[model samples]
Target: MIEKINLNNILFLDIETVPEYKNYRGLDLETQQLWEQKTQYQRKDEVSAEDFYERAGIWAEFGKIITISVGYFINKADIRNFRVTSFWGEEKKILQDFTNLLNTHFNGAQHILCGHNAKEFDIPFIARRMIINEIALPDKLNLFGKKPWEVPHLDTLELWKFGDYKHFTSLKLLTKVLGIPSPKDDIDGSEVAHVYYVENDIDRIITYCEKDVIAVAQIFLKLRREDLLIEDEIIHV
Candidate 1:
């Protein structure tokens, strides 16, 4: 059924995030100690407040979301074109630009929003930040009140689950298992903050995001082909 859906109707997106506060960095030792103390109060699998604060701190230190890489396969066309867009200024302005593009380019079209671990991270992170910045969210992103299965969300990570809920797979590992190149070889999520902060190299961040988007697209192709849901056509990567 996924193949019956037009490829152009899907938006493959990836985001880079950081924290909103700055002063927390100078107190790393104290912060870590406080985080350890706070972990006891959190649910077993949930992130502790201190841990979240630390991650936010790291994100703040690193210029947040230097770019968002998008990939889409146009309908009636055999080729896929990728675009890398940046949120280079204030967070609100960046979100506004992204929203404007989505509305102007993708409005009134039935589309599936695809991303890697997006349901848990990228989507929520962007939405929450947008809300914080008072940016209007697109209709497609207003799925917070909807039931899980009701949303037009396609997380490649979730698809990789293959009906087994307990089998956890990272995007990097999934790509490797599917014989696709691992994008993590060049840059990883952990180093993204450092790359943006220390080096101030936006190209590396953009490249890394682009690599992940490409990897996800490859995986989607593999699924469509091997699962017999789509035509056995060569993917024009």
Candidate 2:
């Protein structure tokens, strides 16, 4: 199926997320109580809710996207250049900008959204955030009444599994196992919330997110049995 699809038809993406507030103390009293209650089972007396707050980004309700970096391939003089752009900072702006990109460029049956584990995490997170921000779901992201084949999304991890539903793979691990370049050279997902909230370095997060997007694109190419694109082949948008 990947072999039949046009390389340029895929819009590859990655997202960086953080807790809605800087720290657990930043949450309001009622919301803090709710967060505590929601995480009780998972915390299991092993950690306090405040300690577990670092992982709030995994939940759409308690977190917000910090950056969404997306890339697409285009041929220029027989050289394929992967162009990337980012929508970042405020969640509303990020969603709005991403929405505009989908509506303007990738809103078609021929276009697809692809990422590592995106179908399970990134895509769903984006959809939930869109609803929370009151933005209309872009056609590609909306799955209402659509059959499985009709879903315009591809997950690299899922493709690698080839129907092995019991296995779980992380992007970092998959990239290493497949001999792809590491996207986590600077910082991994675990440090994102701290980097954003305490260090106040959003540019770092954007860079990390962009690398992940590029890695996703590369992994997709590898899955299609295509040669990898080099650094010179990347064009920043």
Task: Quantify all predictions' global Cα lDDT against the true fold.
Answer: 0.67, 0.91
Q: Which stretches in model 1 have alpha-carbon errors above 4 Å?
A: 21-54, 57-64, 75-87, 226-237
TM-score of 1: 0.77
Tens-place lDDT per residue, model 2, 160-226, is 9999999898989988988899999999999998888789999999999999999999898888888
Q: Compose the digit string of candidate 1's lDDT tens values, residues 1-69.
A: 666777777778887654444334545686557655644544255765544553552222322455666
Error of 1 at 70 (Å): 1.3
Please give the RMSD of candidate 2 to the true structure. Answer: 1.2
Best by TM-score: 2
Candidate 1, residue 147: the lDDT equals 85
Q: Once model 2 is optimally superposed onto the true structure by TM-score, how far is the C-alpha of residue 213 displaced, in angstroms? A: 0.7
